[model samples]
Target: MLRLVTTSLCLYCQRAQVTPLLLTRPHSVIFQEENQLAVNALYDLSVDISKVRKLKGWVLRQSAVYVSETAALLRDMGASGPVIARVLELHPEAILCNPDQMEAQKKLWMSVCASQKDLVGIIEKFPASFFTSSSDHDNQKANIAFFQTLHLNKRIISKLMASAPHSFSRPVKQNEEMIQTLQKTYLDLGGKEDNMKIWLQKLLTQNPYVLLKLPNALHDNLAFLRNVGFTSDELLRLLSKLKGFVTELNPESMRLTLSYSEETLGCTDAELRQIVLQCPALLYYSVPILADRFKGLLAAGVSMEQIMETPTVLELTTQIVQYRIQKLRSFGYDVRSGSLEVLNGTKKDFEMSYGKLRLRQERPLFNPVAPLRTED
Candidate 1:
């Protein structure tokens, strides 16, 4: 019984702790009293209507307060008079309100409430529902898509437009053809994925100023640029540049010059012009470095197609260094310390050798033969 009272109080406290914003919005106040003291307090607060007969009569307003337990307390004769009825009207008493106890009585009802144990079960199920593992390849693809779909800017797209015209162009009739082209490019470049992504992203983010000049550049070019590693910063830069260009160039002239081209992969001559017009800063480091790197990688026994899918020179350099070290170790070379030193087997020979031992000859300590010769 004591446990029941405690649970009721806890539940009531939870309800009471709700923000007053939600509570005050209602027209009436409602409260439940389980304690004898609370009931007594309510009785003391009730008005004595018999003593206030001389008072000018006003229509008594009905109270909406209700109680679901301790209805017997309403008939306390030792306390205040008939005004108890008025208080009851304002604050009705409940016959029974212990929902927890009532629920235990109904065998047909399932447990309607979540207990701490049930919460644990829910939390346990969450891992099965929400957590999943994916391969590195899938993760990379997801990351690529994430960056592409992200709210990137026109500047980034414009830069991409300048370089990846084939990629930035209109949709092909067959996705297989597009995939084949990508694969061919990847193969041609010796499978350098990182280089391809970098170069493509460079074009996509060429210039924000140019992007404004060629509004459709980014929108059309994103698919191809995604193949390359386009970053959010590049996209933002492009958008900023595009906005600047929009302010500088005439809208109609911009439209006419950037008219769509099927061959340029849906990017317009105007877009290309816009890119070049605003190209000074963007082209300075990005475009040239990208082209040179791509070409260098391509020239060095890497196919252009393979270059599109393979790692960059820097990445490959590290991998190659590792591989070389592995090969050297496999071939019986001391990779940790590059050079080798040989030591003789005898104590004297080893002592005299440079590795693992050192020896200093002490002269005259062996003067036994000389002393004997002198004595003779």
Candidate 2:
């Protein structure tokens, strides 16, 4: 009897252990079926399955119904098949969004977009922008309303939504503070009220991301420039040239670049200011890049004075400078003896200069009074 009781107890413990596995087996199979179905649906859409697997495997675990639903909504919105596939592939998280949330997002976007066709185009180009989290929907709506109150063009608002969506994800107060700071800075820098609205619109159009920057960044950069001896008029001009990118710069980085440039060019404070004014890129390019460019010019027998006279040459890469130098040398127009201005411009400009030099070389320095006879 004792042996029989011990055996029965062991059997009961074994059965208990097996019960949970038996219960979970069906659920695991259901998940696998769902994942496989999702994968098959996406594969049918011509999405690059290998990329989705590597970058967003979680998308497979989502319900196949959601994937199909999202794709169907995009199709209904006039998105082409390829565009829908590209959108899903680029932003797999979009599959997790529910139907109502997507509709709400679509409606919000349509407010700024000129038409459903335009909205579809924006979505096709910037899929991630259109598929932002539902939690940001309120903030996005608020930001759009605020921008409209500022009298910004619908086209500009559309661009901001597509290119700088994160700017809309923040609280309206954050954006409002930044805008107020810009306005104050403009007026303080001698900008007139009549031109402020146009100035703001142009600046925003040039760089919508500027609104994302901290207000203090603009303040600090302007203060640094003022300390560097830029008068009110000159500061306003520099701001216009930078196109609101000054907000992206901190005083520390500008100080470092200015110091390095002053030391490298061996110029006084006033002259350094003038160089920066002439070529805003001096404030933008990194030290190592600037060093390499200066080294390349000096290595090729170009004088520092020539670079000072034409600061824009620093914008060219070392390889381009070398290529242009060689091309000029082949034409007997040595850059060392000639002006560095010859090496500064687009490929077309360089080619035009080369063609003119070639013509000059082919022409006779002293033509006789008689016209040269052509062979028939």
Candidate 3:
């Protein structure tokens, strides 16, 4: 079982020995023991009943009046109940933490992203942002420098940090070792040093969790793609275009997705590779979504070859494909054979081409000078 410990409790446990009753009993069974003391630590906001329920652990020791001044600070700064609840869930000790520690966390959040609306995005992504320690602060600076070496700007780095604060929570050396290992592995795979930097930057900037991915995952993705007919040159382009390719992709699922697309589109594996090479994102789309678009296009009389030529149409929504195709067909135009322009042209552009925009009728504007006092 994963050893669950609150950030503050972990610090305390290190210095002092206390086994504290373990709530090892599955959470569902806990309600039967209603007589057992409930442990709710965070303070200030009224918590959700469900949240109150998740806070079920045996009383380690009676916590003193735990004031989450930091949580209060966020509420003061426009954080809502859900947001504060998430903060507590991610770091239960945030409520028990010293005022200064909470302040540092709030400050870090502002530094990374200040907009209250934006806070929901980052906080939801990295709730552990409020758990920074002195060493964590030092490591954060070093981590920034390390990412900067990959040519990421402060804004992107801030976004990355928001998304994966806990990933970079560990010491900087651990991350450094991982990056070095990845770089060496890429070189061993016959990747060019200059190109490897670009690919690595693309991957990490979009999905920093990929950095913490199982060490063999990168090699596996590369090998898997190559075996599935991605040529060496095409693989570089694939990595360049699909930033989350390595981090988010699953090998078995990708093979299934590829096979499903090939069968649905009535294309051979080579033809599938051609379209995927044109639009790398095709591989990322779920099989159902891919099928929906493919059948919609087939219904519109768009040949498989046309799809292969206009790979980007696969990226468009089913509604867009159907709407554009129907609109063009109504106007006696060939929706199937037309280039991307058929699918891409805006409504205004269509009106302009149909000679409607310039001729659009509107009520005549009256002279503002009281019609020059001419009643007639």
- Highest lDDT: give the candidate number: 2
Candidates ranked by lDDT, best first?
2, 3, 1
Q: Give the TM-score of candidate 3.
A: 0.61
Q: After superposition, how far is residue 85 of candidate 3 from its true place, in Å?
A: 11
Error of 2 at 126 (Å): 1.6
Q: How do these models rank on TM-score, best leading?
A: 2, 3, 1
Name the runs in model 3 displaced over 4 angstroms. Answer: 1-68, 71-96, 104-128, 131-152, 170-174, 185-199, 263-270, 286-289, 317-320, 323-334, 340-376
For each candidate, the alpha-carbon lDDT, in order, equals 0.31, 0.82, 0.63
At residue 245, what lDDT does model 1 achieve?
Answer: 28
TM-score for each predicted model, relative to the true structure:
0.15, 0.83, 0.61
Evaluate model 3: give its lDDT: 0.63
lDDT of 2 by residue, 1-376 (tens): 0011112111211322322212356446322323566677788889898888788665554432357778888989888889888988887767666666788988998899888889888887898798777778899999999999989988899998899999998899999999999888889989999998899999998998899999988888988999989999989988988988898888888898999999999999999999989888788888899999999999999998999999999999999999999988886888888898878889999899888888998897886887989999
Candidate 1 structure quality by residue, lDDT tens digits, 1-376: 1122333321222333422222233687643323443334334545443332223111111111123232222232122334343433332321122333322211111121133332223213321111111112233233223334533343343233223322332232222243334334333435455555543344335432232233343333433333333344443344334432222344333333333211222334444433433331222233334445444443444443332222222222333434433444443544233321221123343234422321222222565556454553
Error of 3 at 53 (Å): 8.4
Off by over 4 Å in 2: 1-34, 345-369, 372-376
Candidate 2 local accuracy as lDDT?
Answer: 0.82
The window of 10 residues in a row where model 3 has the poorest summed lDDT is 30-39
Supply candidate 3's per-residue lDDT for 125.
56
List, residue by residue over 249-352, the lDDT tens digit for candidate 3.
77887888888888877888888898888888877788889889888888888888787778778888889878866765664667666665447446666556
